[model samples]
Target: MKTTSSLSRILILVSALLMVSAYFTPLWQISLWAPQYPEGLNMKIWIDRLSGDVDIINGVNHYIGMKHIGQEMFPELQYLVYVFGAIIAFGVLAAILAKRWALYTYLLLLLILGLGVLVDMYLWGYDYGHNLDPSAAIKVPGMAYQPPLIGYKELLNFLAYSGPDTGGWILGASVLLAGLASFREFRAK
Candidate 1:
């Protein structure tokens, strides 16, 4: 088996360490603006919790029949930390082994994990927006208030924006580093 270069191993270790910081920062953010609240309302999605104007956002969402926004609503938060921990551990193991195949496998895992996250978020948003209470106070026929996945969306009177947060950027960087490491290793021969 071909061995990865020392630099590739170092990069893999660094990528694993970078992923650790994701646990300490918010992974995603959503902001809402409306005529009633020009100041805007924001929500930050942390690894295991939610922050920012959660109560206010929930109150607004209630009028539209959307479920209350709460940490308890997201069961994924319970195991997200462990999932990342396992991925990071795998990266470390790949680095220690210093094998090209292992590094490539780590890179593939990162890509799949990233894609899975996006898909999961999209599905959650779809369910949250589409499954409205029948007796909602402000029901508009055939209207679903799904927030944009990565940009701005006008939901009734509210302008909603969704995007990655600090932790997300760090995770992207880790993936980039891992990819670079894999590329370097592949070309080393």
Candidate 2:
């Protein structure tokens, strides 16, 4: 029983570390590294250079949108949903199982921050992806409308510092707290 308790604590601690480390390392960087933009523009660029089609207009924005997300300032990405979801799931479990107020506090903070991030991302998508109807384009011609996949960029960057360490620290800390809570729960059992 003691071993189980200790093991649960260890597991919870590990979970916390993973969730928290995610903030610093940002697992999404996995998506960022050699980001796959829409239609693989890097490859296209290479092919175009070879074929001398560089001047020929391409669906650059759409291609860019589909290929990678982080390069553009305020890039629209729906992927944030998954991140936020993970955060929430961890937070909720911690909240229900955790007896400590500090853990609850972390959960609250996650909720608040998570909601703000979600809203911002949704709006970014709404603004960036709004392609107009062809008929509307003829009459109310305006900025080219982007599809949803290419439009929603998550916007919860820490105001203090936008670097990996800054955001990662906060996110990591949150995960750590969550893991602690889970460990505590397991320990209780």
Q: Specify the poorest-scoring 10-residue window by lDDT in model 1.
A: 180-189
Q: Highest lDDT: give the candidate number.
A: 1
Error (Å) of candidate 2 at residue 32 is 14
- The runs of at least 3 residues in candidate 2 whose Cα sits more than 4 Å from the true structure, single-residue gaps closed, are 1-16, 23-59, 62-99, 131-189
Q: Please provide, for model 1 over 2-94, each residue's C-alpha lDDT reduced to its tens digit, 9 standing for 90 to 100.
A: 998888999999999999987899999999999999999999998899999999999999999999888888898999999899999999999
- Summed backbone clashes in each candidate are 0, 17
Which numbered prediction scores highest in TM-score against the true structure?
Answer: 1
Candidate 2 lDDT over 1-189, as tens digits, reads 122244443444444444544323332111111123322222111100111112221233333232223324243233543555565566445434434443544445565664565465447546654532344312323443332232223321201111223333456555555555545654565
- Residue 169 of model 1, lDDT score: 94
Q: lDDT of each structure?
A: 0.93, 0.38
